[model samples]
Target chain A: MEFEVDEELLDIFVTEASDSLEQWEAISLNLKKNYSADDLNKLFKIAHSLKGTSKSMGFTQLGDFIHKVEDLIAWVIRQDREITASESQFLLTTHGIMKKWLTGLQLNGNTPDVSEVLWTIGEYLKGEIENLDQLNTSNNMQASEAHAATETSQRTGIEFLKVRSDRLDSLIQIIGELSIHQSIITHSLNNNDVQSNNFKLAVHQAAKMTKEIQNESLALRMTEVRGLFQRLERTANDVAESLQKFIEVTITGADQELDRSVVEAIQDPLVHIVRNLVDHGIENEEIRVAEGKSARGQIQFVAIADAGGILLKLCDDGKGLDSEKILEKARQKGLIKDGTELSENEIHKLIFLPEFSTSEQVTEISGRGIGMQVVKDTIAQIGGTINIVSKKGEGSEFHINLPASLNMIDAVVMELQGNKYSIPLQELVEIVDLNNSKLEDTEESHPLLNWRGSLVPLHYLSNELILNQDYAVQREEGSLPQAAMIIKSNDNLLGFGVDRIVGHQRIIVKSINGEHENNDTLKGATILGDGKPSLILSLSDLSDRLKSNHRMEAV
Target chain B: MSEAILQTSEQLENDKYLVFRVGTSYYGISLSEIVEVTEKLDTVPTPNTPDHVIGVVNLRGEVITVVDTRHLLGQEKSESHLNFVIVVNTDKGKVAALVDQMIDVRQINKEIIEESTSSIQSEANSHLLGIAKAEDRLIYILRFKDFIQEALSRLNGER
Candidate 1:
């Protein structure tokens, strides 16, 4: 008899198995604190369900292994005492094996050979009999703590339709096309001066509909960060155990949702940061006791939906970043000038510089200074910024502000030498008439503009960006550089001398992946209402480039 | 499989190409690679871009980089506007190639194309696959990827 796995049933089993494994992890961590019959029942239900599903699906080998674990779970439930540490350990081991088999099945069509795992689990089940007397009688509480979580999950009956990501991508592309056409229609209508109110109203409604559809399609790609945080909790525990330290991980705002792509992109950096927290951030129990702090150090992972983006913070109450040590290392590594004076923020940022690890001892964890630089690069790649703050004995917090979405932005359109350009709206402080604003020139220093009583360095659009050295200075009669944009990034402000303001619009940004992708002055290009590609300017990138003024002339 | 694709590309008359004029020279870009062709539109010149870059223009909803074919062909800068854009789909995305004039699409016999360019002295036309004869004119078949590769190398080498 051939045992052939039904494709549909295997899919169901895989989904159910993964979900059950996730729940198993959560409840197992809870069970570690106090013995809960409800949690045990939930876990038992999952094991029994998998055993039944796998047997029915004809994966007899997988079914048989789970059936053994199910028997052990039944025995544990039948016991009159609180679960012993030895029994609990075995229970966790059973769950681990089940998770591995299910994951292996997902990656490959066939179930893994679990004979060795089955033998090991059988040994633990056999050993569980001798552990019955190990439980203290006082620890067993026999009353029903309502299985509230299971009740809620059953009542909610959350229904989700799995969608191929490519379909959503196609939907977005169509919406992008719709927006472009809508813009062209509106542009033509306005140009031709259509007097019909009904036609104008319809056009506005269509534009609004396109924007809504774009947002909804974007929302489809978002997933809550709860799963990410839960997994990191286990990672923290493992790192702490290896380091022989006691560390508690507290994660908040786990329900906050980010684009799945953004989450995937940031997960590695987050993992490294958490690993650093457990390895380098948290001090050992003995050292902590000497410092008059709790022996168990705490690491907090918090994500907050901020004004324009998500603020992810990883703070640890352990040994803070040694700023002096970092600066010294930077000097030793020739990363800094001999007598460079830096603010505390700049000093803290030195750790992110290449080959600037302050730690005297290198470890498998993070001492090569590779992790922090990776953290910096990953965050920057997503147009996010990271800032570090620390107190010597207290702790350190890494604040990461990631944009709410990656491919879309509200942009202000402007013109430089008759070409349209889009600048992120968040970066533009205000737009002023260049004629109304007073301007002054300097030879050695940057040009100055007296913008509303404050002096700002002003740069001509074509000259600053070097788009064309030969743009006809011969303008029509009295137009003295039509407009100037007050672009800002943090505390630095620069006035961009432009020819005209093209108003504001929300645009879907398509990334320039090849050829000009490495261009520092531009972020990506977007289609305008008139159906032309306008380059989106990165304010931070522009500010950095402007301050340096070293690379602009490189070409 | 490669031979089958080549056979289909041959399809009795060989591959279809979108031929255009750069000065007196005629160049052929594979028809399969072209997305759209348009009369010259207003282009916003990107600052500090390579000299051959015509500018970035709005094509439907795509912001495609426009490259001047005449500049790459090393012909004398024409006094008249290179007012035609042939948007080609490259591996990177859609980029518009500027031409002084556009000719008609024609299937070039693969056997007629001269693969070796030793006799052709123009470095600008170094990436030309070969010259193919059709009717009364000789059309230069271009290797699109090779042209972009050479352009990038030249840009990098310029610095």
Candidate 2:
């Protein structure tokens, strides 16, 4: 039978299916921790909803497959039998199949072997039930997969809600347009001859209404990180079980709300961290027992909001990082000097270096230094910071801090090189007045200032960003500014020269539009309260610009 | 063609081609596809978009991505004294293409069908749906959806 589905409905269906699949993956990962019945219920609900929608949309193959997966999950929950390692992998594979089928359905196509696939999945479900009884009888301590399945079964059921991202995006865009219209109307009224008090009040009320609408629309797109964190538990379990070791995963602060985009971006890195904990961090159960520790290794994921950022802590109580070993590895690899005065933090940071690894044998999870470096780069791109703390034997904890919102931001306005630049207040430490004696620019010497005992590099934003050349020339033969702002990055601090401070303002950040080469330095653009356009400085780029300036001076 | 309602109203009885200019050539888009004419304003630029997409603009708060007519029609960009955004509602979505200036909307009879030239590919061949001769003026009709398809295809190739 033909289905009367509009293109919009089809688009929504595809988006919803994919979103559910992402959530399913998260839940599957969460199964590694003690299974809360809620996660399983949530997973079941998503599968059931997809089944109904796909069937209605005439995507019979996809619909049938989802039905089978949902049925098996329901049976497993009812039986209260622990899921085995192979069974967990089967569920993951089922998720992959569903994703593949959904892609075909999205393109208005059908998946072949739909029935055969469902039958195979059914066989796996039956096999899992049979294995459950055997697992219970054997009660093997080494059976970690069974342990994960058992834990997953005991948790309270969670019902999943399916929402199309396109709907959310369009809603957000519409809200944005409304705000823009309100701004335009306000601007037009200011220019009009009849400037009455009632007109001003009306405009003010409109602005306030639009702002509230925008906030509500944006809030609708946020989901808690619990779903994302849950997946890491399952991943750690799988890895530990594969290595024939006992590992227990714990989750803390699961109720922290994260933007949908952040939740999606953090998934891969979180998975990688879990893999590392299982592979390198967690010792074998025998070794762990011998050390007078619990036979099962423990990995904890904690989420919290600190200051203006969301902090995610992934800690594992296995074997913490060995700073001496890392230093030794660095020296052996000729990447660092032997006996160089490097702090624990500095040594730990080396793990993110390209091709830096202390592993003797490369595993499927990690050993190639590319993983952590990628995590570092990705986190930075999302305007997030990651700090690592590792003790020699206790464990390692990766603390990740991310901004609340990347699109709109509050910035501190400052004049640099006679041109205006807005700096994100998150990275700003403080502003200090530099006396004439403290500031010196020689003919051959670079603009490097010695602040305190450490040398604080001085960078001129005008020279670095070349704003003067791009816009109007800012050199008006005026006295040098006395106040220099000190900004801090992960480890280094730099002082920037600005003409004057223009106080703080909230700005609607417009992303730098184009596929230009200069995208690296320009974070985005923002319109000020008075309708003045300002460039929001990228802290990462600012640091790089400093290095480049020094390199140019050296040349 | 005979059974189809050729003329729905006396005003529309004359095969009037809604003539629009793309670069130097006078092109016509069927009146049925034409939604409205509005000034080019409030275009939100989409970053990393394909080349032909000038950007997206909110028309009554509806974000519609606009295509550059010159770029889509494979013509060179020229400075125009007056330009307007011709909003065309196509099957893909509502799009407003940049037009060099909207000329007069006049009447043209169906008898002016000229067999497309051999050397000069049919204007109908590249989203130019049909051509009609009205006195000395040749009105080039465009298929709105087909035009958008071709433009998107060209962009896909470039990317």
Candidate 3:
């Protein structure tokens, strides 16, 4: 028998299958929270669609797999039984297999072997589910393998939707105020003003609806951090096995939603840090047993939202940082002078210096501290900060703090010579009242401020940008340029003078063409709420420009 | 037989052009090449670019580069601000040519269009093809692709 398919049809199948499987993967994560009728229906519809598309396109095997999944979903919904954790994981693994098989089919008409997956689903369908104990053991052995094969390893950079979270937050905040006003009006009208609580209740009801709509829209732009955690888990397993060690990664807060661009930027650094844990942080089984601990090493990978940022804590119960060795290495590298008393935190931070490595011997599994500098550089590049806390013989924890979203950042809007400009909120260290701050060289030399114990440079943006000012009108003499936006770039702190601080708003940035992109001062331009182009400034670019200018003057 | 017939019809209509004036000088580009003509846009100047580049304008939510056609032709800059932007399609993407006004469209025969010598003093002459007539008024027919290529090269080189 001969079955034929055209190239165009195959292309459509691959694209459609990839999208469905990706959606299935995200839903499989959500089903962990609470199973709703809508989710079940969505799952069933997706499976049925895949089955129909594949079968009609003459892909018998792929269609058969999807058909089996559809049957399982239909059965689960009919029975109304709570989906076991193992069942959900199995469903996710099936999506992985289908997606990979699609990739294979595209390359050469080869299909994946899903008999193992089918058998597992069959057991659940027949109500002869595998015991939890058996599933746990199997999970320990297979969790790492399946995750590596599935989404993360082969996944493209997560899609970045250029939108403003600040704008969304403002909308959310406005609706909140409207509801509050309704409550106030309700109290007055019921007693003295009019005579109706219905108006108040209705306003409250409208607010609730808007709130739900806001949450749903926000959810569209965010994905669970669990997908990233799984990639790290896979790295741990591969590296641990290669080093002949046993390591298990347990993750909590896997449901934290994150911006795709933040996830993309942190993926490589997270991999490096996890590989370091397996190769250096976790002790060998024999050593663990001798130390009165379990033979298998344990790693707790946690993700949580904390204080306006995403916090990732990677901890391993293994041999902690050897301070003696690190101190010696630091001294040898001339990072610190002899007999210099430094705090434990400062000593640990020395590992991030250029070319600093404590790994005596390098192997295939990434050497610890070898690319710690790279990890540090990358984290800094993404507007993130890293901290290391460790105690000898106990364990080590690396805490990384990253902004909530990358594409849309909160910006402080400033009024400069009647033009609106914005500076990123994260880059601002403080805003100084120039009248209170002491001026160092106001008249003759370069302008510097006596900031606390050190001198900080002051750059007038108007002077730097050489903006033409036609101040045809005069101001009152005492109306000094009082406010300044102080930002820290590299190790230098500088102040930019603005006429007025207009307040903060979330902005979506659009790129400027050729020369402006390479220009040191301007980051990009964003259209204002009033439909005018406003420039977003970069302090790092300003600092670099200042330093170069200062160097040229000295020469 | 059908292929020969199609070629004949295409050649007959190929000389049809849309005539527009950038300054006092009148010019014509192929009718098929213009994408749109828009009222003066609120353009934002990009710092440190070539002098001929007026700026970029947000045209119906899409940003397109705007060029000062008078300066590109090495003629006197327009005394009065020219507000109309003639949006044209090119291999390099869409760009707007600043012009004082849009004149008219006419079909010209090949015989009446006299080819110009390449030795004209202005650099833009290399891109201007020949002189033709539309209702007794002379229209300067242009090979716009050459002009577009020159514009793209300047954009890249300046960067």
Q: Which regions of candidate 1 fall more than 4 Å away from where they truly are?
A: A1-21, A29-35, A47-75, A78-116, A128-201, A338-340, A367-369, A428-436, A451-455, A468-493, A550-555, B1-10, B78-80, B117-126, B149-159
DockQ of candidate 2 relative to the true structure: 0.06
lDDT of 1 at A187: 73
lDDT by residue (A1-555, candidate 1, tens digit) is 125566566556666766777788777656755798888888889888878887877667878988877777787788855776656644544555566566555445444465755665566567633652122111111000011122223233433334558758767776776676677667768777566664576577677767677777877777777877876675575466446678777889998877776776787687778878788889989999999999899989899999778898999999998888888778878888998898888888887876555557877655533468888888887778888988778999999988878888788898765678898876778888876777788874457999878888877665667563332233355455678788776577788777888898888887652367566667788888777778887766776877766566655
lDDT tens digits, residues A1-555, model 3? 016577677666676677677678667656744666678789899999889988888788878888888997888788887776656655655655676677666655666576766676677667687532343333333443444443353364232244457757766776776677677767766777544565556666667766565454655577678778866765675566457788767889998868776787788788888888778889989899999977888988998898677899999988878888899999988889998997787778888888777788786567544488889767766668888998888888999998776656678887665666778887898887887888777663448877777787777655555432221123345555657878887656888777778788877666553234345456666777667666677766667777788799989
Comparing 2 with 3 on DockQ, the higher-scoring candidate is 3
What shift in Å separates residue B67 of candidate 2 from its native position after superposition?
19
Between 1 and 2, whose DockQ is larger?
Answer: 1
Error of 2 at A11 (Å): 4.5
Identify the candidate with maximal DockQ: 1
TM-score of chain A of each: 0.78, 0.77, 0.63
In candidate 3, the residue pairs with backbone N, CA or C atoms under 3 Å apart (3 or more residues apart, or in different chains) clash, namely none
**Top TM-score model:** 1
Segments of candidate 3 deviating more than 4 angstroms: A1-57, A60-99, A104-219, A264-269, A287-294, A317-400, A433-438, A442-445, A450-454, A466-482, A511-522, A548-555, B1-35, B47-56, B62-82, B86-159
Candidate 2 local lDDT, A1-555, one digit each (tens): 245567667667766776777778777765644467777788889888988988888877677778887887897789887765555555565665665555444444554355555555566566633432232222222223322332232232222344557757766776666666566666667778237665666567667767766666666666777777766776676576556778777778898877776776767777777788888998988888898889888888898988766899998887889887888888888988766798889999998887776666888556534478888878877778888998888989999998766665678887765445677887678776666427556554346666675567676545455321322344667666656678886567888777788888766566532222234555666655544446667755667756776799889
The deviation in Å at residue A432 for candidate 3 is 3.5
lDDT of 3 by residue, B1-159 (tens): 999999988977787787888766788888667778778876655433566776666666555567777778767776255768888776556777777787777777778888886565275778877888667676788877568558756764763
Q: Give the TM-score of candidate 1.
A: 0.79
